[model samples]
Target: MKKAYRIKKDKEFQLVFQKGASFANRQLVIYYLEKKDQQHFRVGLSVSKKIGNAVTRNQVKRYIRQAFIDLENRIKDNYDIIIIARNPVKDMDYHEIKKSMQHLFYKTELYK
Candidate 1:
């Protein structure tokens, strides 16, 4: 994802966590806050060290970013969305990760 579309700051992540509505499945947790002033959606990804080593964490993040890129057009354009990967994600491949994320998005009505 582009720099403009990513949430990279600690403060921003905290705001979303404190104020956003959340939805989850076994593999992922999503927290989304509506941002009416923004022209498009922004995403933050979190993969804890507990999930794996650096390479594994980065791979999980890459997969999540790819899923968002593929679903860009279908996702709502006015929210700041944060995705937190759970332990089960370490065992999942790209497609499984994408499916789990899609489930959470649909549950939260973020998918259009």
Candidate 2:
């Protein structure tokens, strides 16, 4: 498990948990709340069984984590980004997955 602050119990996460506002040509339900003493950003990958079995879900999580690692060096900001995996992601390639996250950050104005 990743050692980082979790938004699991945060009110903002729950409030923005629903499908709503979108950006980067993608429909993302984002909750942007501030965090102090957060030395780094932590990403939470949310994969549901509706997308696939345990293996498939874990694969997506791994892919998301790798994508984050690749971008972490270039990414600048403080956030607890939780990516909810959509069914379409199961068929998407790594580049697409990476771009989706990068776009999300860009759209959210999290990138400097």
Q: What TM-score does model 1 achieve against the real structure?
A: 0.98
lDDT of each: 0.94, 0.65
In candidate 1, which residue pairs clash?
none
lDDT string, candidate 1, 1-112, tens digits: 8999999999999999999999888899999999999999999999999999999999999999999999999999999999999999998999999888888888899977
Over 17-96, each residue of candidate 2 has an lDDT whose tens digit, in order, gives: 44323343442233354355567776555677987888888888788778877888665556556677778877777888
* Superposition error at 50 for model 1 (Å): 0.7
Q: What C-alpha lDDT, on a 0 to 100 scale, does residue 58 get in candidate 2? A: 82
lDDT of 1: 0.94
RMSD of each: 0.6, 3.4
